[model samples]
Target: MLFLLSPAKSLDYETPVPAEVPATIPHFEAPRGPSTELIRLLREKSPQQIATLMHLSDNLSALNVARYKAWSGRSTPENARQAAFAFDGDVYGGLDARSFTPAQLDWAQAHVCILSGLYGVLRPLDLLQPYRLEMGTALANRHGKDLYAFWGSRIADHLNERLAADRTPVVVNLASQEYFRAVDRKALKARVVECVFEEWKTDRYKIVSFHAKRARGLLARWAVLHKAATPRALEKFDLEGYGFDAEASAPERLVFRRKT
Candidate 1:
């Protein structure tokens, strides 16, 4: 994962990739991970204080949440997934978490996965901003449930603007599905944002997104698991296109302009 710190080095991948902003995105590339002092400050502060800090200064931003937290090689994106799997298959979850319900996890995972939103584990740098700002604002307002809802809305807006600027398709997560579906969609002919996930057993779950009404015959049924799971190392996965696991749970739905 340390190698991912330099975006230039990461650009050599074979797949067509999203335009990145290395500085802003959180990855495995910080000077000291996180300091003990920072975690103490965060733990002591109220959510409102955290939110205010997020909006006012970069010093105590939400991105700092996982700075010092430790991750094993399985979750590190280092040590090549194959080796991690060979050594500790259960840790990295080669089959993806979709096989289990979010409710079934332990306190730590519930805090990290459900509450902390994986603390920028798999997300890219540029993509983190919209969600970060949205979460910060919502936390400040004390509208907790609305965090995801508001995040979805703001992300949808950001995606709309990015799409209009370029006709490029990129990888996104299930967390943003509700948001993307809320777009008014001004003039971007190519409206696809490939969603990457892990099915229960294994492999990336692929979701193809577009204006649901317009996608009609282009993708056959409204939803289906077109690409099955993959075996081998983590790098063996294909992350460059539209995909989703139809067999998994229902994605969060985003309602756009409502009609009577």
Candidate 2:
């Protein structure tokens, strides 16, 4: 089973990566790559345009504008950090890639895939540069008026290729709906399973954005540390205070609930 995750908007490029962790190039950043094409378009937008497009403050808009201008065609150790370590948000907070050992990171690199607006799909160890682009962004490109239209079936095709060797070829969807929408379901060749994390709010179990995001990361972390390969193994996930809700789970949707 391959686990899907969403890229965090908040980034941490200041921390030093461990000497043991290695980085690889993103698939979409190859020569004449999709990312390169997208970057070319992003470079055209002025800081004010970016601010309006992404609804950012002056400071944030200027920062990203500079990032777009400074982006290089090639990723280097000096310019990039591993994707898992670079992302810093609620989802990544639970992931806590910093604590992972070299062996665990190696396993995560193969089993985990992070959905991105710019790079498409990123493995845990893929080299990443600092940037802020959400999947829902309406960045017009040759493909269409939005990033989703631009991505089309490319994301699903990539996932299919990666799952070709797997016996079951199951895709565990831990990504937010915005990012997951980029993966064309018709083009994908795997059984997609959605994991729902709910919290006991007031009188019932309800989904909270912050807690759910962190739970997704916790689940992903559990899968990596345990080396969970089968869907059955995932049901056994009981990290943080969460417990699998057998009654609430369906064949395609697995629900985990927690009471705090």
Candidate 3:
């Protein structure tokens, strides 16, 4: 089984990561052309243009501008951090990768993939530079209009390749729609199962974005901790108040609901 997750915009590179887990280069660049092309394009844009494009504040835009300028695509332990450890959004908060043991990280490195705008697809231990280009961003590229077009079927093909090696060959999609859309569903050979987390509100069960994102992270963490090898193994996940709702679930969509 393979798990897909979205990269976080908020980063925590300042925090110290455990020294035991050595950082690895992202597969996008090595043995290939420079992956810094996106950064090159980004660098062409002025800070003001970037601010308008990404709808960021002056300070945030300037910060990212500096980041893009400093991005060398050549990542080292001293300059860059692992994708899992650097991400500090709600999802990463629940993932808490800093607490994961070396063995758990090893499992995650093989089983998990993080979808990104700049780096394309990343493994858990992949080294990453700090930047903020969301998958949903409308940055026009040579491929077409958006990042999705630039990525096209490449992400799907990579996932299919990874799935081909797996025994179960199933994709557990924990990523949001924006990120998942980057993957070409028709090209992928693996069965895709989406995990949904919902809360029982006053009237009905609804998906709260914040809670659902965190739940996705928690589920990923649980899967790594237990070394889930199949989609069926994931059905047993019951993290943070979430319980699998078989009645509400379908073959493609697994629903987990929390009463709170």
Candidate 4:
């Protein structure tokens, strides 16, 4: 089984990663190809323009502008860190990759895939340079109006390649809607299963953004720890007060609810 996740905007490169988890090269390079073109377009824009485009403060915009300028095509352990270790958003907080053992990381490296605006698709151990370009950004590129247009069928094709190597070849989509939209479902050969995490609110079960995001990471963590290879194994996931709701779940969409 393969898992899909969204890249985080918040980064934590300074935090020391576990010495056992060795960093590897990203499956695809952004600096040399279409991603390079996107960066080129970004370089043309001023910090103020960037702030306006991404809705960032002056300081954040300045920081990203420096990051964009410093982003050389070449990535090394000295210059870049692994995607899993670099990200520190809510989803990543639950993932807590820094605590994982090398063996667990090895399992994750094969099963987990992180979708990105600049990098397109990344494996867990893939080396990444710091930059903030969300998948939903409206940055016009040569392909069309947005990053989606530029990525087109490329991401889907890459997923297919990864799935072809897997025995089960099922995609567990833990990414948010905005990031998942980048993947061309029709182009993919593997069966896609969307995981939904909901909370029992006043009236009924509903998806709370923050809790659901963390739950997604928890599920990913479960998969890696258990070395889950089948879709059925996913339903057994029970962590952080979440339990699989068989009645609420469908074949394509697995629902896990927490009564908190």
* C-alpha TM-score for every candidate: 0.25, 0.98, 0.96, 0.96
Candidate 3, residues 98-140, lDDT tens digits: the string is 8888898998999999999988899989998888999998888
User: Which pairs of residues have clashing backbones in candidate 3?
Assistant: none
Clashing pairs in 2: none
Q: In terms of lDDT, which candidate is strongest? A: 2
lDDT of 1 by residue, 181-217 (tens): 3333343233333323322223432222322212211
| Model 2 clash number | 0
Stretches of candidate 3 exceeding 4 Å from the true structure: 31-34
Error of 1 at 162 (Å): 1.7
Model 2 lowest lDDT segment of ten: 30-39
Residue runs of model 4 more than 4 Å from their true location after superposition: none
Instruction: Tell me the lDDT of model 3 at 259.
Output: 92
Instruction: TM-score for candidate 2, please give it.
Output: 0.98
Model 4: per-residue lDDT, tens digit, 1-260? 88999989899988887676788877667457766777888999999999999999999999999999988777898889999999989899888887788888999999999999998999889989999999999998878998899899999999999888776579999999999999998898889999999999998999999998999899999999999888788999999999999999998899999899
In angstroms, the error of model 4 at 62 is 1.1
How much is the lDDT of residue 101 in candidate 4? 85
Top candidate by TM-score: 2
**Which candidate order results from sorting by lDDT in descending order?**
2, 4, 3, 1
Cα-lDDT of candidate 3:
0.89
TM-score-superior candidate, 1 or 4: 4
